[model samples]
Target: MRFLLVEDNAELADAVVQRLGLDGHAVDHAGTLAAAEDCLAVAEYDLILLDVMLPDGDGRDFLSRHRDHLETPVIVLTARSQISDRVGALDQGADDYITKPFDFSELEARCRAVLRRRGGAAKNEITLGEAVFDPMAGTLRHGAQVLDLRNRELRLLEVFARAQGQILSKGQLLDRLFSMDADVTENAIEVYVGRLRKKLDGVGVRIETVRGLGYRMDT
Candidate 1:
């Protein structure tokens, strides 16, 4: 999944980014509301991790301003443990609130739970022909054998699964598969698509190219 992290603390930002990246998620870090807004304009995120206090303004204010526009789930990370603070953040549109000095495992769990709620399932499995795509496990399996999918490949599959039977333009897939700072080319998407095609060949799944439009995943 792709995430936007609004945080001013460099250390905490770095730790969050590194940990989430290891879990096969693309993260973009913004130190202020301005930077976060910039990121939001360019990409659609699966989730957002927002700090309550930012360099530019309060995260709750930012949340309130954009809540109507953004349906993406947000998890607020703040040092204020007061009940009012938590209630205020939630009322301002935060999906979950996690106080500082919290464990990364707990953060991970919260993210998963929020995403699950958004997707409407805990497993959120997608059937690809005879194969099954599991977002939580980050794998594609056919009966007993698990297909060897790299992180990007698996992420691409997840994106397609979520929007199954719909055409996805190259730009949309690019934003979902790569981070804002990733030094990747448009043709790189074709490379990954080609690889996925070969692996899924003869399986119930098909990646169809719609002439000049883009690609669609069909089952």
Candidate 2:
């Protein structure tokens, strides 16, 4: 999984990033809101570990600004242990809140639990005709053969699988796969979809293009 850590404390940030890396997650660190915004603009993170206080602004403000558009889960890490602080963060759509001087183990567990719950809510395996994608393992299987997929391809598959038969626009896919600040054009999504279509064809999975509407998985 990929993560973004937004914390200004140099030492604390280093420790958290190293610990999370040791846990097998690719982590990116940002020391300020601007830096964090830049990272968020280009990368699609699985989870965001946001510090309540930053050099420029409060994390809550950032969450308020982007919560509607970004679906990635967020966990607020703050020194404020007040009930109001916790309530405000949750009300702003944070998935969880952790107080400062927190146990690293507990933080790791919370991250895992939140991700597990999200995956559980959206089934790991999606079946469309003869094709099945095991998202947890990042594998695409068809009958006896297993197809190779790139990271972006797997992310694309997850989006389609989660949506099932629903029509998803190219814009929507880009938003989900890339950050809002990404400089990628809409055509980039089409390219990825085209590549995915070829792989799906090789395995007998039916991914249909709905003309101007975009793509869908036909079961």
Candidate 3:
């Protein structure tokens, strides 16, 4: 899953980012509200770990501004453990709350649970045209033939299947498949798409390129 960690403390932010990365999550760190806002404007995150107090503004205010516009689940992380603060954040549309100095395991568990609930079991199997992909097993089947897909191919297909018909740009796909620090080129995305296209042909699923826009799955 992809996550946005909004925290002002550089040390804590680094720790969180490293730990989350170890847990197989793509994490982006934002030290201020402005950076967080910029990240939100461009990319979609599976979950957000928001610190209540940011350098420029309160995280609650940020949530108020974008909660309704984005479907991403947010978990507020704050030192303020008051009942009122928790209630306010929740009422403002936070999916979960974590107090500061908490265990990273608990936070990780909450993040996974929230994403699972949001994604649901139906998302485990994606069907596009004659192709059926089982994410848990990392298997792609096109009728009677099974296509051999690499790890990156599976991840790419999963992202497109999750978005389905939605247009996803190369940048967005790179961020979803790799970390913020990955040294991926624009051509890398094209190469992956070309590879996926060949495997998808066996199943009669077509991944259409949208000129200068991006790529989309066509059933």
Q: Is candidate 2 or candidate 3 better by TM-score?
A: 3
lDDT rank order: 1, 3, 2
Q: Judged by lDDT, which candidate is best?
A: 1
Error of 3 at 18 (Å): 2.1
Write candidate 3's Cα lDDT for 59-86 as tens digits. Answer: 9999999888879999999899899999
- Summarize candidate 2's per-residue lDDT along 1-219 as a digit string, tens digits: 577899999999889977775543557789999999998877788899999999999999999999999999999999998999999999998999999999999898788667767666544566756877776567888888888888778778877877878999987787677643347888988898988888888555667889989888866
lDDT agreement with native, every candidate: 0.90, 0.82, 0.83
Clashes of 2: 0
Which residue pairs show collisions in model 2?
none
What is the TM-score (0 to 1) of candidate 2? 0.61
Q: After superposition, how far is residue 195 of candidate 2 from its true place, in Å?
A: 0.8
TM-score of each: 0.93, 0.61, 0.69
Single out the weakest 10-residue window by summed lDDT for candidate 2. 174-183
Q: Count clashes in each candidate, considering only residues at least 3 apart in sequence or on different chains.
A: 1, 0, 0
- Alpha-carbon RMSD to native, per candidate: 1.6, 5.8, 4.2
Pick out the ten consecutive residues of candidate 1 with the lowest summed lDDT: 119-128
| Segments in model 2 whose C-alpha atoms lie over 4 Å from true places | 1-5, 9-47, 56-72, 77-113, 119-123, 202-204
